[model samples]
Target: MAPKDVMTNCHAKSILNAMNALRKSSTLCDVTLRVEQKDFAAHRIVLAACSDYFCAMFTSELSEKDKPYVDIQGLTASTMEILLDFVYTETVHVTVENVQELLPAACLLQLKGVKQACCEFLESQLDPSNCLGIRDFAETHNCVDLMQAAEVFSQKHFPEVVQHEEFILLNREEVEKLIKCDEIQVDSEEPVFEAVINWVKHSKKEREDSLPELLQYVRMPLLTPRYITDVIDTE
Candidate 1:
């Protein structure tokens, strides 16, 4: 074999295998991660090498450096378990169901790889029914790209999305923001007017006061004289 081809086999594969072996041996682990009431045994060197959060905790003269058990708050035991698995194996399987829960944990841990994976999974699951909610969630988590994608989806499918239960459940501020957007998909403003009417009717007593503000978004001149007279005559 040529010199370059002789060592074509990956050396990193062997290192990963060794790390996996160490991960399985609880007896060799020097540190324990305590999440909620559960504890996970882990090696300090592997964790420090893989995670910047752990690296800083271990390298600095911080309390975590001397402690055998480090208590991790705000993350559930199951989420931490999957994150640690990724740290050891360099692989993660993100699904739509778990992505919502895992993304926040990954963010807190400063695991960029897992966070990005979760964002991509969420982007794949976006649809007319859930786009607005996903946009809000992504913005809250500081996922800029995912938030923008969800917003565009919401704008393009506003007509269909407005009929979903999720749209009815939106808070007053959120509903107002969406109606104010010029990009909302409504043909000739009739659907926009009808959607606002339906929205107010959904919670008549409380939403009645919002009719004037919501109606301003609809182009009154585009509606036929008889259609407007028939709908607004009794109001």
Candidate 2:
């Protein structure tokens, strides 16, 4: 049998034994194992191996009404099966959730095709709304290329998203932390401050007449002492 098949068989046997132990034991254990199985064969292998334990675990402790709580169904089974295959054979078909997990695995396995697929999938799936999560995931995985792509995409398309007063102000608190962090480089441009100033100026220009209060705020002597000094010296 192929190495993947061997691994799958081994994992299935392990799962079965764990289930049998649960069935034979009188006491309920606090442990819960979550599996994502993708293929029917993989599900069958798991079910056949651990049916006794699963049956007991489901039937004894939980009521019929609560069966859904333990019952394996839908995408969960398929995902688990795929994961099993990947763990064993170092290859498996792709899916969205699996793609997220597979990228790191591909990198570990040095599987060029799988790694490229993961990158492509991420690039295609990413949007202004999902960019933050993608950025975080890429960063966590140390996928430098993917992280750069995500950052560039966000900076271009989602600039306004992060430019909100709330985000800018909140993130500013960590400017020092970010600067000190060896991993990330802080830009000297101060995009947040510049964005805010530009927004205020644009709003003022759009108004039928710039609000007197706003004008007064911007024109306040203390607001631009350097500019005021420059003008006075020039005069």
Candidate 3:
């Protein structure tokens, strides 16, 4: 008889589900990941399959490769659990309360998908009051798209944004960066000037010296003659 070839229908989820069950039972687990005083048992192969971090750690001659237990720093135990769930199920849970912490942890694990999802969630939550804070957060985390989106939103809502505490807390360079942008949406130069003054006076002793520098960016030519003589002169 001629050689016969056969194929069987199978789904990938079955394998993951089986692995998840084994993980829960602590069966065939090769390592225990310790985080924040909690120990999580898992299979190195499964972790290697999901995270570049684990893959490199297990494959390289690093001290952790042959260790029976490894300590995971810079992450809370809950975050570690969430990441493990994602590795085993290809799913994750994100919420407003957790995203700020989760995104950094995901980045450390080199889980780009999780980091992107967290960034999108933050972007969706942006508003006039919070856009500045979000932009700063995105910048600190190197989430380029989120930072750009937040910047555009901040400009679109500049009038309302200056009223928030986040704007007042911005350092000199950050304030200069915002006011110097020609794209800042303001009906007149009045608001821009007011924003600069407010930011400077928030810590007058420390920031007062920068007032003249920031004022230079506010276009005086755009102000009306009456207001300039009245409001502008009084300042």
TM-scores of all candidate predictions against the true structure: 0.87, 0.36, 0.88
* Top lDDT hit: 3
lDDT of 1: 0.84
lDDT of 2: 0.47
TM-score of 1: 0.87
Q: lDDT for model 3, please.
A: 0.88
Give the candidate number with the greatest TM-score: 3
Residues 129-156 of candidate 1 have per-residue lDDT tens digits of: 8998899899999999999999889888
Better of 1 and 3 by lDDT: 3
lDDT tens readout by residue for model 3, 1-235: 9998886555688899999999999999999999998999999999888889999999999999999999999999999999899989888888998998899999899887788889999999999889998988889889999999999999989989999999998999999999899888999888998888777767778886787678788986755545533543344
Candidate 3 TM-score to native: 0.88
Which of 1 and 2 is the better model by lDDT?
A: 1
Model 3 stretches astray by more than 4 angstroms: 1-10, 222-235
Ranking by TM-score: 3, 1, 2
lDDT of 2 at 52: 47
